[model samples]
Target chain A: MNQTAMAENKAITISFPEELSEVQEMVRACIQCGTCSGSCPNEFAMDFTPRRLWRMVLMGQKDDIFKSKTFSLCSSCYYCTLRCPRGLPLTEAMAALKQIAAKDGLSKYKQSSLFYKSFLESVRRHGKVREMEFMTMYFTAMKSPFLPFRFAALGMRLMGKGKVHIQIPSKGEGKLKAIFRKVEEMEGR
Target chain B: MNYLYYPGCSLEGSALEYNLSTIAFMEAMGIELTEIEDWTCCGASAAESVSHLLSLALPARNLALAETMELDADLMIPCSACYLNLRNVAEKIKKEPDILNEINTVLKEDNLELKGDIQVRHLLDVVATDLGADSLAPKIRKSLDGLSIAPYYGCQCLRPYTVFDDPEKPTTMEPLINVTGARVHAWDMGGKCCGASHMNTKMDVGMELVAAILRAARGADAVVTVCPMCQMNLEAYQKKISATYGEDLSMTILYLPQLIGLAIGLSDKDLRLDLNLSITESFRNKLNNDCVK
Candidate 1:
């Protein structure tokens, strides 16, 4: 790998290319009026805040911004985008930044993302999100050995509470395979 | 009107009842849903969050399949996650031609292309627009009297674009609720995030988020949502929250279609009341049996 690529991989933070004129335009759209920061419920918890994230994107400090925990804390409620005086897509920008951060394998908040992956993949393969029985097994296997009892505890509790339904496969298995093929192709899997 | 339908992962699985009811409800409304020949996952919130290319490629592949079908009709996505992913891919492709080309190259093997011809509209948009409120109101044989519903738009369908309505405070489902004679509960968190995928990642954070939404939705009969992720999070995690917080607020969550189906005179059996986590028996009792039957 070349110096720049190697440097980028280890940079801990990342930014998109300058040719991504969309990011530039979006950054320009943000007047840094702090409406987003003001409206953001989690802004106080975030290190760099939304306004600073926008600024970093504009300044091409991609690596530094992507590494921050602020991007992960963006709940994507879109209060920022809706409240922004410039009508900038601040929430959308945060969502994009979160994706970029995940690309570099640096999601500080990954449990939900991991569940989303396993559950989604299961649905793609099974042609349905089966209720408790399959979901528990899948999640347990995925989060195995680390917190094995947590999975069992979750399952037993859900069952006791009657939250976990015994969902049947409403469709045939062939349909699932076809759906899986298409989804896997999309994921380049 | 005909549509190239993309069911996505949820309809086929966890939200199967939603899928069944949507198909039934749409057919009842005279909308033709031509299931795309071989559609795939839209990566939903996970793949895209983890891998951007996978997210775009997943939806792009479906879009390409719809294009190859040569269907000039709009592609109606019932699932909110699928709708968002498909719309995002279309929007991204317009900006990143190279990514589009690269995706098309992958589709070459499968004989598809992610052309942006197909208009991706949510099931709610079709029900509200295609079958006008007047049309829907008359069709509502079972008026949902005394039933108070909190219209939850969730985060996916409304935001990112002004395609349908205002994201921060959306009321797309309110008119439908009004038409059914079910009172729409005035709540501040209609378009708010319910801690969504966070429920799985950080259980406490997720439960707290759901708790906030539920607490805000106090005094409502039930919470109606469009997205499966939202429904799953709100419905499945409520018990955990109630246990953790020592509060009891069990709200019945239903897909917009399921609620509409009930109002338009479909039975609870047809709407799959069994799948829900809340007091569906009470909800079922609320539906006017004479009109629905």
Candidate 2:
């Protein structure tokens, strides 16, 4: 076999990480029917259609898979999962892919991952999301000075409607601290 | 009837109208709600992306707290995302004892355990199944007679679980809308995705999806939603989405309970209708002229 053929063979046999074993198992059942992609509301925005991503998953194109924003673009509507002819848990697989990206600390997903982290951090602190505080944290962590301005009009509208509550940061009641702490320790993060 | 209520974060903040209207509507229906003490966030759609276990554990913590209440009643969640998260935990633990044990090991940090005993239900499920349209009809003091409402179920409430309503062709809300004397707007976007958190993460995509739903709901006076994320996406972005799409995609977006509150003769203050973002002047006039007692 020539070098190019050998490389193609190697690509075809690449292994997915253990974190995605469940997704791997489920995606293997996909018939490439495109039902998931067809059902996806965000398919147009995805770098790769969900069907194409599933095909890549089968082919173990891990690098190409992570390079695309397909999974992160999943809004978790579960329409794909619902419409999957094989009942493949497509949404959960998408979520598992997100989990892998998050666990790997992939820079490609930094913005979105940071958003989720900021959200959970707020929840961990207050036992609930303080909207203004959460957004503030996310914007600050994002280090994007223009980000808050983008939401300024909407934020003002929400505040005008009494939807956004401004709270001075203080020690939270620590309602979920123990749970968060234990999970962090267990997850070995 | 009673329930252990889990008003997730958005209900307290952005979706306060959902909370207020829910309380008033449920109370008027002769149902009592006992709020779960120290009920934390149910991780929404973000948690599972970060940690699958944290997602389950966060909701499981709330479930454990509900179990401690000893209510023997199903835990009712108003937010669809919260409902899905908590319901996912409940369903997962029921199917896998090992998963339950793992979550319990984490919950032990909070001095809680996952027994998987309490049933988790969305408010829509409770309203449609437990308090059927027939039981609720007599409570109507003012008829929303001519107003056409698009019953937008969004995504979470009906999908992946299929608990009380058909995931694809949901008709439960139509009967409830009929009981209020409003016409159900004929549209197929009821079960569609409203871009959800992508409104924050990926604005273009979210805007496009929101524009589609809003455009599809043009003939209706208002779009009735059951999810906070959906309500916010549909209500808050109308002006921008309209501008981007070069169409007048303006419509009143409100909670299902708020609509019911109006039918039941609850005050606007009771329903927090003023807090809703995109309630048009025409919609207000219609409600005031026809639905007000």
Candidate 3:
């Protein structure tokens, strides 16, 4: 191909923004040995295996990477990171991908992202996670009436065992307010 | 030896049995644990998915609180996820001074500062390493002999950071189990993933992994784990997993310290065994016959 043609082809391919520099740098050392995919416990559930995801990451296929639920399905087992001969931080990279998706407000990751948000919000309020409150907030935010029913049996069992405590929601001790505020200010969120 | 304890959010809630058993077992062993006052959450795995800085800052705040105590001792955590979160920040701050400085800036808001000098140790490390089999053997008031127990290490305790045990194949818990006079059930699922929060986010995937672990645990009288997430997953999902897989996958799941507490002559109430989801009658009978004075 001619120089102009090569430049045109490169421009047509989707490229990652500067935000993904750390992830890109980490994945650059991938030898494509498929050790990550082989080691991943949830690989069968992922739309794209970890190996293919790393390849897309290396090629800067940002759109394709975002469309797949590969990173969201990661259970953070760290098996791949441990087995990878290249010693890449695969688990951290997966977390980084989730962080970017959450920051960008991708629609596909709405449920999982909302779950994390509700969890942190509980922490922010009480300095500890009140499971009943957190799950209530999550179910409400999800707007799925049927979602609570799905977990109702387990919830009842836990409550029966005195595992779930019911307390009136009050303003928490606010122990983490300063830390959360400081982090928010630092991250400029 | 005395140590600063950070019982993350779960200990006060769903994993209260773990907290109860840990304190009882440690007291019996004569180890001192001073709870860190006014400590906040460690952000678990949730904070990282939301904000990396918040994840570091949340845990750093606790470390700063520990530092203020001037305990000159390690900060011990019982929850695997909390251990990973705190240890991750501690290791990062040690390797990169700038990250420590950045986290310190956030801690400044709470009138705290992290020196990044305190060591973070898991309860398993303290038990298996600090109190080895030699020290544990004589304390076995009730022998767990003939009870085939599977030692399940789960993932977080061993992985991403292989400080005290092998990430892939862990034998630390085995020796501890043997010291209780129990035969360690030979199994490869000890260090496997329990699907972590995926059980909440993606139920099918988490159930699949849990089913695999439970199936591999067959022939063992019970599965003993150090991490609360693993305990909850292995015990809570048996009915659903069995229904999904069309097999009897029920297995008794106990916290590591709970099992140790039993062998060390602690009562069932002390270990909170009733709080556990599944405890086989045979296993209970064995404990009653051998351990109960």
Candidate 4:
């Protein structure tokens, strides 16, 4: 709304940090509308709402954006993206933020990041996840034995119903491993 | 029609009932489903968070395998997350040939290439749309009369791409539910997020959201979902969510196939309804068909 400030600021094009260059397009297209924040289900839990986060991205506030859970809290429900008037890939932006956070060794949601790591590892090794194995690996990987006990009742119920499985994961182990190897080699991870 | 089926990881483990019910329902309907050989995880809720390329690649491998087999029919994925992953990657490969090429370079050594030729569809879509309502009507042996059903369209299947129905407000399940002779509860919370796998990552946040949907479906006899994660969170975690909210928000949750399976006179064993954590007395006694026996 400040024409004077806007006119003064217009001459200098702001460049985001190299890591955030991808989101510059998204931030530029943004109308500073709070629709994304308004539409987000987890907006109430977000420290800095998505609308404010976009503005921060424009201002090259990498530290602030990374510190905040705005992107990390995104579960990829696609509500904000679906509701965005600018037709931005808001969900993908959130995914990119997570990628950046991981790259920077900054995890806002520790539990979530750990879970993702454990789940991905399970798939990487077996080409399929056996629930019991996945949970054990997750708990062990996180070094928090108490967490599994928290869901013990529900876990037991799943087991009781014959839902919990122990199996020899078959079919194309060689090919599956090859895919993981390729991705790992490509990502240099 | 014959189709390549991708069950995903959840169905084999935590969401086994979804797998069983889907298979039973499909078999009863004469829909042949051959499980895609040596299928791996589609990286469901986690793969994308860690790495986008890994997320796309994991699902792409499965797609590539299906394509390699030359299974020409549309791929039928039972779980919503897998359906979304497969469909997203398949479309991505079509629209942005670069992504497919990127994946193929890795896949090349193994003699695999993600051609993205297959039409990835959800079990819900196959039954509701392809199988159709009119044809399904005659198949229902025991009608689900007097049961108010809430069709929970949890996040994945209907978002970013409105593959089968409206994203914000979906009614794809209505025709299927109707043909089974049940009353569809036209509630606003149908398309709400189930917080996905956040139930593990962010328990309090995820549980609260699940509680709200369960509360919204208060009047309905049962909430039927097409996604394993949705059904698991709503059913398995309902009690926990209830305790958190300090409300007795107990409700029965079933997969869409389970409801149709029951209506088609398929017994409890066939549908694996016993495996569901939240089988309400009303549902078990009235609609489960086991009561009739």
Compose the digit string of candidate 3's lDDT tens values, residues A69-141.
Answer: 9999988889999999999999989988888888776655778999999888889998888888888888988
The TM-score obtained by model 4 is 0.92
Worst 10 residues of 2 chain A by lDDT: A7-16
Per-residue alpha-carbon lDDT of model 3 for B185-290, expressed as tens digits? Answer: 9999999999988888889999999999999999999999989889888988788899999999988899999998888899889999988988988778877774
Estimate, for each residue in B1-293, the C-alpha lDDT of model 4 and write its tens digit.
99899999999888888888898988998989988897888988687777778888888888888986676698998788898888889878888888888988877756777767788988877887788888788887887788889999888888888878899888988988888888999799988988887788778888878888988999888999999889888988877777778998889998988988888889889988778888888667776454332
DockQ, candidate 1, comes to 0.27
Candidate 1 displacement at residue B104 in angstroms: 1.9
Off by over 4 Å in 1: A1-30, A41-48, A55-67, A86-89, A107-189, B94-99, B288-293
What TM-score against the true fold does each predicted structure earn?
0.80, 0.95, 0.95, 0.92
What TM-score, to 2 decimals, does candidate 2 have?
Answer: 0.95
| Model 2 stretches astray by more than 4 angstroms | A1-16, A168-173, B290-293
What DockQ do the predictions score, one after another?
0.27, 0.76, 0.71, 0.58
Best by DockQ: 2
Model 4 lDDT tens row, A1-189: 597655434432223245478777656899988899988888878899999998988887776787677888887888888889988888888887776666545545456677777677667677787677667777876787588788788878877777785433333244367767777778766
Would you list the clashing residue pairs of candidate 4? none
Q: What tens digits encode model 2's per-residue C-alpha lDDT throughout B1-293?
A: 99999999999888999999999999998899999997888998889998888989999988998989998798999999999999998898778889998999998887888788899899999999999899988888899998999999988999899999889989889999999999999999999999988889889999989988888998899999999999999998889888888889999998999998888888889999889998999999988884534
True contacts kept of each: 0.32, 0.92, 0.91, 0.78
Off by over 4 Å in 4: A1-17, A165-175, B288-293
Score candidate 1 by lDDT: 0.71
Model 3's alpha-carbon lDDT is 0.88
